[model samples]
Target: MGNQPMIVMSEDSQRTSGDDAQSMNITAGKAVAEAARTTLGPKGMDKMLVGSSGNVVVTNDGVTILQEMEIEHPAANMIVEVAQTQEEEVSDGTTSAVVVGGDLLGQAEDLLDQDVHATSIEQGYRQASEEAKAILEEQAIDVGADDTELLEQIAATAMTGKGAENAKGRLAELVVDAVTSVADDAGVDTDNIKIETVVGGAIEDSELVDGVVVDKDRVSDAMPYFVEDANVAVIDDALEVAETEIDTEVNVTDPDQLEEFLDREQEQLRAMVDDIVDAGADVVFAEDGIDDMAQQFLADAGILAVRRTKSSDAAQIARATGAQVVGNVGDIEADDLGFAGTVSQQSVGGSQQLVVEDVEDASSVTLLLRGGTEHVVDEVERAIGDSLGVVRITLEDGKALPGGGAPETNLALELRDFADSVGGREQLAVEAFADALESIPRTLAENGGLDPIDSLVDLRSQHDAGQSSAGLDAYSGDVIDMETEGVVEPLRVKTQAIDSATEAAVMLLRIDDVIAAGDLKGGQIDGDDGGDDGGPPAGAGGPGGMGGMGGMGGGMGGMM
Candidate 1:
């Protein structure tokens, strides 16, 4: 009955299981949330992220911050995906979604500490998320494409905390005009609305063009700068003679043969120009290089030409001018030509740009954004992107809800009631989920320099009295109805945020094991000699290293 010796087997891979794994994942999730929670509402601050190459990006947008960071933790990456999904679906509310997801995990950790099963927490969160979605649908207000005023409000709501907040009113109007101008029976076609930004002018000087804007000016000074009632042709191919597919020698032994070859090439180029002129076109957009001879022919025929136009710009021009882009010049005809009321080359913001304006029944348009600096222009572009996205969402979904965390507070209130009806340990998880929903308004108040506890208390009182639309007034630090105050967002944003945040939190809760392969190629963790640096183990720095609730709560409290 005596064993020679006791032997144990071990694997090379580093594995973290049970409570240790859950703690690590939750800590990582909360760290990600803590990073973005500071940038939550209208009063949120911006982050200046400097890259390894010294490139700098200053933004409060959640997706930009997460994308720029080099996050290594797998659980943290999942949180980043939540923000990405929010941005993709609603184009705004990314920060809120991520923060809420982090809070959900934080709350689940508390329940786990109380010995609650992970499955019960997951089930409770799923039920709570469904209830939240239903609540958002019930709280939504109707919107339509024809309602420009409402659309402007939506844009302003998105741009409130962005760098362009000062000029949000003007930019919102321009965004609304551009989206409505390009809207079709299918809905708003945002691609058809091009945005061109140039640094120098004030933000107030930005304007919307009823037609397209090409960055390229006239190809030659001899070309006409302005053509009225222009007949435009979009050529997707080169205006020069087609090149031979394979290498060849012309074998021109005499000057006469050389002259004939040169003249033949010129004739070919001239014939291409002649085809356009015969088609009754006064302006041409060539997607590839236009030979010098062709330009001379076009100019001599009183036609304006732009060469090497970007494919996107060319498609936009065709849309604005009602032209069909022809792959071959020989296929072009008068009927294939497009029309524009005026095609002119002008000096705009110290740059030469081709302006195609005053087109009748034009379905495509452009917005020229002006600013005093490169950073300003970049921020303006981001702000306008969000604005346009919300406008499109409102047009397509035809519904919206009050912003400033009103819907979230209402969900918290209703979820608490729902939690009371459930009689089990799962009820504790449901109650935790309700408390997690309050992080939004609490964050908004915290970011706005108000006492989160005081603000949340007042908000709860207001929502409990049947005033569900009541939300925090970040500016004044008062409880007020966001809907009545003109602070609103697309309904899809709220529903998607709740759905994505809950899904991420639930998925993370079910992860109880983490296995990491040793880096043999790096020769650090899996050394041949088994050399140890007396350092912590591979997974030691994970949740085991995380300071408990007090430490994390202190970190989060500092954000307020």
Candidate 2:
């Protein structure tokens, strides 16, 4: 009895404790970071992720890359959440957030090896994160909504490493215009700015429409192709005869009775079309289907009709035209109709599209992105989306910072100085946090094909000399003024990235044990009761379960 081992848990359960668990989790975090490291900065390379279904997505966007990856480690997924949070809050800087998070864990790993307590590291990181945000606030430059030139630079900075780089200048102008056009006193709602991509033309052919653009075409070719000074009616209801809710049979023995039933159906549809005509609507955008009979009546009335428009598109059109979306067409009135300068059907990239443009004071607009191929268009769309996000943030927050890793380099220098104020072992953690931030500029230099050490040294020297805006110029590998180079990003992008990265790093640092329960039928663990089902061995950490930290390295390797 004295020599017997006590077993309280299931035989199929696996547990990893102490230093082994910490090391495995840290390694996982670093691996996830390393995967996105090369895809940072303006010279950053893009990643082509191939899924199990053989679907390929080629992009440098941090959130997109992490989301597309099939990560199994729970700790690694936490790092992915950092990127997702950044994307959700700022719409840009996902790569920076993820890279910083990974580097923070890497720095913490070095501290852990030095016998420093994880609690001290976590506390130090919290202090550094708060100080880093303060430094960002002090260094942020004021940007107003009317600063169109500066705003364009912000958009261009976001598009630099993306597929739209060659034509970023023109696209930046379009993005700024689109954003500013839709901005109201309540703040900018990005949803009001829609992006529509058309394949088969150079990216430079992209243009900003003053109003909404629907992918749908006119219901009938007989309908007017164009309407000037158009009035639009947006309806959510179908233009077909209403059917009874319950199933019932209509018994019609007489020919007259059958003829009356058909006549009534036509009249109901005609009335639906008449509602638009009576409301003086030159264009109709329907959320539901438009019956063939109703289409003929609409076409005869010289009204441009688009049927089965996506609800989102219909809502945007309504916002652009200042019209209210009515559920019942018969309830429409003249005031309920929206006004547009022109409603026309055009062939874009060999596809028929309805364009509503030149609406006065439009609250919704579209950017018609053109590209040479489907992949090109997709990449361009992604770039434009990022640009729009940053620009919108700048407009709403009214604060921005210089890019090219300027903010990070400055924060590192500032945090190191602040670490002195935060004494004790926690100060070491703060200093480590600072060092982790330098990775941003180092990776930027490396991606730009420059000497990382020399680039980092130059940036540190500049920041120490009170030149806070100094950062690596990826093109020349020189430490120059990012603001002078027109490299600017929304202040929220930097602040949010630091906050999210720090929180994720701290959360991962506090973990020291992992326990995974195995299933006998699934054969996740090696035991006498386990079935012969083919699954990764108990040590392999199959899928979402962390098996014994044995599969940690392999899980991280899969991400790479």
Instruction: Name the top TM-score candidate.
Output: 2
TM for every model, in the order presented, reads: 0.88, 0.90
lDDT of the structure predicted as candidate 2: 0.84
Off by over 4 Å in 1: 1-14, 242-254, 360-362, 516-560
Backbone clash count for every predicted candidate, in the order shown:
0, 0
Q: RMSD to native for every prediction? A: 5.6, 4.6
lDDT of 2 at 491: 96
Return the number of clashes found in candidate 2. Answer: 0
**How high is the lDDT of residue 87 in model 1?**
86
The candidate 2 region of ten consecutive residues with least summed lDDT is 520-529
lDDT of candidates 1 onward, in order = 0.84, 0.84
Q: Please write out the lDDT profile of model 2 over residues 57-109, one tens digit for every residue.
A: 88888888777765556777799899989988888999999999999998998
Give candidate 2 misplaced runs (Cα > 4 Å).
Answer: 1-12, 243-257, 517-559
Q: Residue by residue across 1-560, what tens digits does model 1's lDDT show?
A: 39776534245556678998898788768777877898889899987766656677788999987777655467777999999998887788899999999999999999999999999999889888887788789879999877788889999999988888999999999999999888888888888899999999899899998889999998888989999999999999999888899998789899999999999999999989889999999999999999988889989999999999999999898888889999999889998888999999988899999999877646878899999999889888888888899999999999999988898898998988998887778788888888998999999999999999999999989988988889899999999988888888999988898899999999999999876664212111111122355642333245323211111211122221
